[model samples]
Target: MSRDRTRTRERSGDAGEEFDAEFELDSELDPDADEDRTRADPDDASGGFRSRAAERAGALFAPRIFIAALLVTVGALFATSTFIPLPGAGLAGVFAAAFLFGAVLKDRRYAETVLSGALAAGGSAVLDFAVVALFGGVGLPLVAVAGGLGAVVAAVGTYFGRDLRKGLTQDL
Candidate 1:
């Protein structure tokens, strides 16, 4: 009304009930600008690397991180041992730690970090088994029994320590 410097009025049977229902535009706002800003999927987040990567990121990280940590711990302990001059023992321990960690942490991507390590450890343990067999020190059956015992220990640790068994049934 101030811009126009004029006004109009209407009366509804002298009750002053007439209301102005029309809206006048200021001419500065664009009418069709908003349509361009929206998209069907906006950045198309559901397709390509973003989608799979987002899904796998969490799955891959869990087992690998735990395995790495376990390897570090087992490796440190093996290195600090005074008697065994075999660096291969430390390497084998790292691998066994990886396998134990993988099996315990998550079912997904379990063997990638630990498989090679396990092979090396298996060879070393076999050699140890032969020596123990000849000398009646650490024989094959004894080592096998020890291995079974170690598995039980690891299973219990995974169960009570981090609840890794729960990860197996997690919705992928």
Candidate 2:
């Protein structure tokens, strides 16, 4: 006995989603006029200018330093609160810890990166949860606030720490 074969695929892309399939009929059925199909370039990058810019941004920022910093910040904040008295001083401690870590241990900014991630993730989540309980739902705004704070902390910490190490590296 002969059997027909069919293949089905569910496809999704930046533009949209689709379903495609190929089928084989035994003894080959004649092609139907209604079955006409057109082909489009799968790898086409053509999407106007800003669409292209968005694509580029997604490619660059979606996966790179920003995400890394967030992850690092949140992790660092969680792993250790460190020691600081004032709220402002607490933020300073966070940054200073990262800076000191990047400077002293020469730890390849892993310490700082984790710090940023922790701050972004944990600190933001905590703040949001706390505020929500106190003041009611503020929506997902907390994520943005936390993320922004994390980025600032990570960038400033890494920048100053790296800068501090520049000439000092010569001595060591």
Candidate 3:
């Protein structure tokens, strides 16, 4: 079977005049058509590699997820420092924030979730370093260690959160 689709395009210029352009597209409805193609082959030369790379990058470090994780981690750390005032309060806050974020995350991909947690931890570590630097001189090594530890802690927390989410959603 064949179908005709009509599309209208409206154009306006600086002269304030408007015109409408109409076009008809003829398409054939074929049962054998490849309609289920989801991803482009990476080896293809016609921009497929770029698109595939972009898709992988987007999946790994989505901007929205990264920003949300960073904000949540920072907020939790600030709240913990202000209210708890414990020795390891920042780490505890990061873990809790990451756990809650992971549990609420809609994406079920493991790599993305873990990477988001790590990035968030690293960002919070930098922020903490900046704040501490204002008080007195601090060593870069300390920041590095804090970032590494935060990454590990956040990763563990996110893992447990994901497990909790899976357990809750699964059918008995």
Candidate 4:
């Protein structure tokens, strides 16, 4: 049995030198032992089942920051609508809001900024629909378009904002 378990091979350059390697058959080891060791305790209070990505995402979308961003965006939109009587003013407000939000955050991750911007826009769209629904109905597809446009504007705004931050922090 030992001889069958052992493998022998000759070295290519060595003169009659042999190497032996031993391997264990599957039947010799208990597969359930590994499963038992790796399985997590169902009664454990610690969050051992959560993945790293989920943890990072949760950290990125902290409630305080997210709510602040949304409020800022909505306020900017309303202020722009009230003060500026021009086309695309709401979008400009969204861009500015996203830019400011990105600039204010200490963390360098842009995903949070972009997500906030998109959600803000989506929220605004819902509000718009709520108001318009009183008079007439609007299509739901428009809200999705607004969200996508918000994401793009947010990405651009975040890029410029981060660039400004970098420039300010750099040595002259």
Q: In candidate 1, how many Å is residue 70 off? A: 6.2
Tens digits of per-residue lDDT, candidate 3, 1-172, equal 4445576766676767777776434324554332222233334445656766898898777877766777877777768867986655777887887788778886754454455445555655566567675466664665667767777877887888888988999999
lDDT of 1 by residue, 2-108 (tens): 12123446677878787555443422254433333223346654454475687787666555564565455345435533345664344434434554554565454
TM-score ranking, best first: 3, 4, 2, 1
Please, what is the whole-model Cα lDDT of each candidate in the order they appear?
Answer: 0.47, 0.54, 0.67, 0.68
Compute each candidate's TM-score over C-alphas.
0.31, 0.40, 0.65, 0.60
Candidate 1 least-lDDT 10 residues: 32-41
* lDDT score of residue 157 within candidate 3: 77
Predicted candidate 2 versus true structure: per-residue lDDT over 25-57, tens digit per residue:
643553442132111333443534446689766
TM-score winner between candidates 1 and 3: 3
List runs of model 4 lying over 4 Å from the truth.
1-55, 126-138
Candidate 2 lDDT score relative to the true structure: 0.54
The TM-score of candidate 3 is: 0.65
Root-mean-square deviation of each candidate, in angstroms?
16.8, 14.5, 8.6, 14.3
Cα displacement (angstroms), candidate 4, residue 76, comes to 0.9
Clashing pairs in 3: none
Backbone clashes, each candidate: 0, 19, 0, 0
